[model samples]
Target: MIRPDGFDAVVVGSGPNGLVAAVTMAEAGRRVLLVEAADRFGGGLRTEELTLPGFRHDVCATVLALAVASPAFRALRLDQPVAGHGPPPVEWAHAPIAAAHPLDKQPAVLVHRDLERTAGELGQDSAAWRATVGAAARAGDPLVDTLLAPLSLPRAPLGAARFGALAALPATVLGRTLFRTERGRAVLAGMAAHSMLDLRSPITSGYGLMLAALAHHVGWPVAVGGSQSVADALVARLVANGGEVVGGWAVRDLQELPPARLVLLDLTPRQVLAVAGDRLPPRYRRRLSRFRYGPGVFKLDWALSGPVPWSDPSVSRAGTVHLGGTLDEIALSEAEVAAGRHPARPYVLLTQPTVADPTRAPASRHVLWAYCHVPNGSGRDMTEAIEAQIERFAPGFRDLVLARHALGPADLEARNANLVGGDIGGGEASLSQFARRPRYSPHPWATPVPGLYICSASTPPGGGAHGMGGWQAARLALRRDRQA
Candidate 1:
C-alpha cells in the first residue's frame, strides 16, 4: 500500500520500537515508510531455526514485559482474543516462579505469584518480600508511568512523590530487610540483576521487583509460535493502516533516504550521527558523542532432545528461569561481569518455549533459549561455562542438547548495528544515563534539528522489551509535525 512517492514520515529501523512508532504514525493518517537493514522486517523479534531445522528460537528478547502495558499495543489489540484452543495452562500460563533459582548442591528457592504462599515459602524473610514488592505492586500504575515515561518531560508531582518515596531505599538494604532466607534473598537479587546493574548496587532492584509484580499481576506470556508472532502482529497493523516496510535494504546513510516532512531515527545515538553527519546540531552531536554503551552478552539457542530437567520441577512451568545458584552466588557472578571479566559461573537466563507452545519443535523435543551477561564485546565463547551452569542445576543438561548455536558480541553487533558491541539496552542503564540518556538534553527525543528525533532504548527508561521510547518519540514527532 505504499504510495511509492516518499512519505509524510519515515522510520529508519525495524526494531519493536521502530515498528511501534511507524504504526502510531500511520494510524494518525500519515503516509509512513519503514525501512529495515536486514532481509526480514522484525529486529529483535525475529525467530529462526538456528540449532535445528524444525526447532524455532527467538534471536533476542524472549519475555513479553512492557509490551502488554504499552498503551499503543493495548489500543491496537496486539495479542488479545486468544485464537485456537490448546492446553488451558498454555492459553496464558499465568504462574511464574520467582523463587526458582537452583542452588549448588542444595535445595532451590521457589516464589509463586501468591504473596502469602511466597512468604510462607520464604519462612522468616517473607515479611520483607511481602512489604517491598507488595507496596510497589499495589501502587504500580503511577510508579510504572513514571518509570516508563520519558524523563525529558516534567515529572508528575504526585507520581514523583510516590517514586521518590520508593526510590529512597537501597536495593541491598531492601532485600536484606525483606527476606532472611538465602533462597528468598537470591531470588530477589536475580530479579534485580535484570537491571544490568551491579547486584550489590542501590536502586537496581526497582525494575526487577516492578517487573516481577507485573508478571504476577499479568503473567509473562509469549505468543503461541514465538516472539516473531508479536512483531508480525504489529507489522500487520502497520500495513493494514497503509504503511510500507522496505526489507533487505540496509540504511548506511540518512541522506540517501527519500524526502519526508519528518524523520524519526529509531536507532542508537551513535548510528544516528553516523548516518546523518552534519545534519545534526554541534551541541546535539557533542551530547550523542559522549553517550555510553553497557556490558555485552553471549547468547545461545539450543535444540534439546527433551525438556530441561530442572532440579526444581516447577522451574519448567515458569516462562523465565534465572540460573545462577543462590542469591549470594548470583551477586558474585554479576559483580564479576560488572568488573570487566566473565564470571567463573555467569548468571544464566533460560526460557523454554516448546514447553509452552508445542509448535516450536517436533514432538517432545524442545527448543531451549538462554543468555548470560559477559563483559561488553567479550568474544570468549562461554558456551561451556553456560552449559556447566545449567548442568550444575540440571544434572544431565549436556546429554539433552541435540544441537546448539551461539552469537558473541561482535556477531550481535553485526546482526543489529544498534547493539554496538552487544549493548542490547541501547546504551548502559546507569543513574546519570537513565534520565539524561543519550545526553543531558531536556528533550531526549528532540534533536537540535527540528524534524529529527532519537527514538530507541538509548532514551529514557533505558532498555527493556517496552516501546515507551517510541511512543514518547512519536508523540513528540506528531506534535512537531502538526506545528510545522
Candidate 2:
C-alpha cells in the first residue's frame, strides 16, 4: 500500500514540532507527508467538548502568548492574508487583564498589557519591576529570537547578557533578594511556578521573568473559538504549500514509513527509544533511556452556570489566574511536588477563557480549565485540592460548576502518549537537562541515526507552544540535504 517513491520527507507525530517541520520542508519545495497517531492533527493544540454538549474546552494548551511572541510564528505571518490563501483563519482574543494573582487579605496583583499601569499599582516595587520585566519586554523580538534558540550564538548578545544576569538565579532567591514588595515577589513566584520545578531550583527565575515579559509585550491571548483554530491555521498553511497530512496513522517503526530522504520525529526521548528501537547505537539508546522526566499534572475542566464569582471582581476580567496566595506559599507547594508529595494546598494555574472569548460556552455560561503539578506518574486525584484553591480566591466557585471533568497523570498519558505520565513540558527543564538536553551537540535535533532527526520539546529551548524546535530541525535537514 505504500508509494515508496512518492515523498521526499516524512514527519511523524503531528505536534507543533512535526507540523512546523512539515510546513518548512514543503515550503522549500520538498514533497512532505505529515502523520499523526491521534484522530486529530494538533497535539497540545487540540480542543474538544469535554463536558456537556455546546460547552467547548481546550484539551491542552490555551494561552498563545508564546505563539504571538515567537520568531518562528512571526515568520509565518498568520495574522496577515497570504497572497492566494486569503485571510488566515486564526485571530487572537485578548482579555482586559492578562493575568492576576489573588491574595487573602489584599486586592489581587494584576498584570495589564500596559507596563506602566502594571508597575503603577506595585507601590515601592514599581521601579524594580520596570528594571527587570520591563527591560525584557523592551528588548522584544531580538531577545526572543536568541532565547528560543538556546544552543545557538546569541543574536542579541547585549540583551542575552542582561537576561543571564538574573536568569541563573532561583525564583525563591530572586524574589526575596531583588524585590521588596510582597506583591512583586508573589506575582513573580506565580509565573515561575509554571516551570513545575522547585521554586528554589536554578533558572526558575528565567521562566517567571519571561512570562511576565510576554504578558507586557504581547498580552496573553487565546484563539477566538478555541486553541484548535491555531492547529487548523497551521494545517491550512501546510496544505497551501502542498504538504499532505495523514491523521490517525501511528508510526510504530522506521520500517512502517515510506522511503524518504529525511524523517523527523516529533517525540520525546521515551517514544524515540520505543519507535527507533534497536536501530539506534547502544550508547545513543542509553542516553535516551537516561533522559529524566519532570513532574506530572492533575487537570480539571468545568462548565460553569455563570462566571466564577471571584471575591475580587477585577480577577474575573483576567484571562489567567494563579491561585496559591503568596510567594512563600507557592514555593512550598512546588517544593512539595518536587519532593514527590502533593501539597495540601497545591498551586493551581487556572484560565478563564470566557473572560476573553465567550464563544466557548452557551450564552451567559462559562468554561474553565486548570491543572496543578504532581509527582511524575502519580495517580492521585487532585479535584478536591484544586477546587479548594479556586474557592479560596473565588468564593461560591463550586456552585457555578454545571459539570466538571478531572484527569490525573495516567488519564493524560492515555489520551496523548506524548504526555508520557503527564510531564507535558516534554521532560525536565532542570539545570543539567537545560545544558545537555537528551545529549548535547551543536545540533541537538540531529540524532546519530543518519537521515533521522528528533524535533520535540525534549531538545534545546524546551517546551512551550513555540515551534522553534521544529523550525530549527527542518532548517538543519535542508542544509544537510544540500550538502549530501
Candidate 3:
C-alpha cells in the first residue's frame, strides 16, 4: 500500500482520554490522528440501542462530575452545562433515608445533597457532615485545581500552598472526622466504596473523599444525551483542529503503526506490553507485569416505564445514586468482592439519565443505569440482584421495568480490552497506583519507547473520565516533538 503522510502524533483509542489527548495536541498546532478499534469513536462513552431501537443507554460512565473538575477542560474552552440535566432536581434522588440494618432498631442512614438540610436531618452526626464536605466545599476550587493540573507546575505560590495542605490529609482522618453520624459516615463511606479497596484501607478513604468533594462542588450530572455527547464534543474539537480519526483499527504491534514522531496509546499496561514487546526496558516491563488490577463489576440497564418510585424522594433528584444501604453494609459488600466471593448484597452505583435528558428515551420512558461490585472477570448476570437492591428501596421497582439487560465483568472486558478482567478505573486506585499508575516513572505520559506514551485511565489519577492521563501524555509528546 502507498504510504500516508506521517503525522506529528498518533493516539490509539477514542475514549474520553484518547479524544482529550488528540484535542490537546491539535490545539497545540500539531498534526494528530486518533485511531479506534471499534467501528465508531468514543469507547466507553458511547450511547447505543442495547435495550430497544427507540430506547438508548449509556455503555459505561454516565456521570459528568470528573469532566467538570478536570483542569484540562478549563483550558479547552469547552462548554459543558450541568443544569440542563435537571441537576440537583430531577437528576438526584434518594434510595432510603434509613439503613436497612438486619435487626438494628436504629433507622437507616440518609444521604442528602444539601449540606445544611442533610446535617439538620441527621440526628447526631450533623457536626461531622458540616465539617468535612462543608470544609472541602469551602476549599474546593483550589483543591481541585491542584489535583487536576500536571505534577510539574510551570503557579501562584498561595494557590500551590493551599492545594498542598489539602492533599496531605490521610484517608481515615478525613473520612472519620468529616461525617460523624452513622448516616453521614455511611454516605461518605459509600462514595469511597467506588474503589475496589477495603473501606478501612489506608488510602481508600482519600479516594472516596476526593470524589465526594467534587460531587459537592459540582453536582454529579450526566451528559445532556448520554456520556457520548462528551466523546462527540471532544472528537469534534479534535477534527475542527485538523485531527483525523480512523475507526476499526486494532493496533497489535508498534511496528505496524505509520511513521510518527510520537505514539500515544489509550490502553492498559498489558496492551502496551503486547504492542511494544521487547522494545520496552526490562525494569519497565517487569513493573508493568506486576501492576495490580482491581475487582470487576456487573452492570444492569433498565428501561423503566417511569421514574424509579424511590421511597426517599431526595435520591430521585440526584444525577447519580449510591445504592448500598449503610456504611457497614457497603463496606461488607466491598469486602466480599475483595475476597473474590460474590456477595448476594452488592453495592451498586446507579443513575437515571432520562430524568435529566429526554433524549435518552421516549417522553414517558426512562433509562436506569446501574452497576454492582463483583469479583474480577465474574460472568454472573446481576440483573436480578441489582433489581432486588433497587426494589429494597423502591418497593415497586420490578413492576415498572419494561426491559432490562445485564453485563458481567467478562462481557465488559470483551467490549473494552482496557477493562481487563472487567477491572474499570483502568485497574485499581491503590495508593502507589494513584500517582504512579502503570509505571513509577516521573513522566507517566512518557513510556520506555522514545516515541510512545500511555494516555488512558491506567495513567495518573488512575480512573474516571477526567482525561488528565491523555492531556498529560499528549502535552509531553508534543513538547518532546518540538524539542526534536
Candidate 4:
C-alpha cells in the first residue's frame, strides 16, 4: 500500500515501457503510481473504432512478435493466464503466413513461421537464409536478449559475434551480397524497410535480420480483441500487484508529480525537455535538445466491406503485407523520404488483423490498415497515392473500403505526444542513437537527477513492443534504493 507520505515510485507516462516499469516496481513490493495524460493507459498500444463503428483498429503497434519474445514480458508471465483460466489476459492470434511481399509481375514472397518452408521458397538463396537468419534463430532467446539489450554481456558470444558481423552492414549491401536471387533480396528489403532508415544506412541489415529471425522464433501475432488488450492486461497486472493508475493526469513539470523516491518517465526527449528541463543539468539537457528524430509516417485505416482482394489470393492469409515492387523500388522510396521528398510510389506496409482474429471486425466484414513513410512533420495528404498503390496490387481495393481515416505526422503527434512528428520507432534507430540515446552513459536510464530515470522507446533496444528499457530502469531503481 502507498504510505500516507507518498508512493515509493511514480511513473509519468503509461506506454508499454512505463507500464512495465510500474509493474516491475510494484511486484517488487514497492508502492507504485502510474499516471497518464491520455484517457486510457496505453500509449502507442492503443486501439479504436478509427474508421467506423464495430471496426476496431490498432492506432499504432499491432504485431506482438517482440512482446512474445521479450524477457521482461516473459518474466511477468504475459504469455500465460492466471491460475483459474477464463482466458489469457492477452490472447495471441497468429495468421498462417506471418508476412508477405508482393511483386509487380511475380508471385508474392511469403515469410512463413517455418524457417525451412520460407527457406525452400527462396530456392538458390535457401542456404544463405538458413546460414544468416537461421543462425540467429538457433541461438534462440539468449541471442535475442543480448540484441534487445546490446550493452549487456552476451550469453552466446559466438552467436552475437556471428550475428553482429552480418548485422553491421547496410541492408542493401547484405541483401545483395548474401542472396543471389531477386526473391531473396526483395524479402530482405521488405523486412529492412521496417527500420524507416535508408536501406544504405549502416546497421539497417541488423534491423531486417532480427525481424526475420523473430518470425521464425515467434510468429508475428496480434493481440486478440485489439492491441489495447495488451495494455489492459499490463494494467491489470499492475493493479493486482497493488499499483495505482490514474488517467487524464498530465504532468507539465517535475513539480506537478507527487512526492516519490523515484520517478520514471515513459516519454521521449522532447516531452522530457518540456516537463523536466529545469531540473536536469545543463549538459544532459543540451544533449537531449540535439537528439534527432527520423522519418515520420502517413497512416490510413479503413473499414472494409470484405478482405483486400490481392492479385495473389495467398496474400490474404498473411497478417502483414509489404507493397513495394522489389528491393530497388523499396530502397528508392525510403531514400526519397530520407531526402525529405515523398515518393510517388512509396513503400507501403499493410496489416489485416481480421485475417487471424475475426473479432476485430463485424460479421464477415474486415478492416485494412496501411502506412507509408514521409518526411518528419509532413502535412501533405497521401490518401490518393496510398489507395492507388494498394489498388495496384489489390485490384478493386477501393471498392472494399466502407470508410477511411487518415493521420499525418502532426495529427499523430497531437493524438499521442510520444509519437512526436509520427516517428513511431521512437527517435531515430541509427547506430549512434542506439548507443547514446538521449545521451551516452553507463546507465542512460538514470539521469543525473536523484531518484529519477527515463525508460522510453528512445532508449536502447530503440523501438518495438519489448519493455527492456523499463525492465532495466526498474532493476537499477531497486538496486539504488537498497544501497541508499
How much lDDT does each candidate structure score?
0.76, 0.90, 0.74, 0.90
- For all predictions, the C-alpha RMSD in Å is 3.3, 1.4, 4.7, 1.6
Evaluation by lDDT, superior candidate among 1 and 3: 1
Per-residue C-alpha lDDT of model 3 across residues 1-484, encoded as one tens digit per residue? 2139778888998888898899999889988888888887888888887887778898998776777777776676556333233112112222222112211224434444455765676767777656555566556666676666537652344544643454345444455565555666676766777777767666676566567666557656676667777777777778778888888889898787788888899999888889889999999999889878888888888888888877765556555677777777888888888888887878888877776677889888888888988878887777788878888877798999898888788888888889888888888877767766876667987877788899988888678888888888888887788788
Q: On lDDT, who's better, 1 or 2?
A: 2
Angstrom error at residue 311, model 3: 2.1
Candidate 4 whole-model C-alpha lDDT, 0 to 1: 0.90
- Which of 1 and 3 is ahead in TM-score? 1
Worst 10 residues of 4 by lDDT: 79-88
TM-score of each: 0.93, 0.98, 0.89, 0.98
Residues 175-275, model 4: lDDT tens digits:
99999988999999999999999999999999899999999998899999999988888888888888888998888998877799999999999998999
> Considering TM-score, which of the candidate structures 1 and 2 is the better prediction for this target?
2
lDDT of 2 at 109: 97
Candidate 1 lDDT over residue span 293-336, tens digit each: 88888999999998788886767776678888666777788788
lDDT of predicted model 1: 0.76
Give the poorly placed runs of model 1, Cα more than 4 Å off: 1-4, 80-99, 150-170
Residues 1-484 of candidate 2: C-alpha lDDT, one tens digit per residue: 3455768889998778788888889889998989999999989998899999998899889998988888788878777655565336688999999999999979999999999999999988999889999999999988888899888888889998999889889999999998998899999999999999999999999999999999998999999899888887788888888888888898888888888989999999999988999999999999999999999999999999998999899999999999999999999999999999999999999999999999999999999999999999998999999999999888889988889998889998888888988899989998899877789789989999888999898887888898888899999999999899
Error in Å for residue 444 of model 4: 0.9
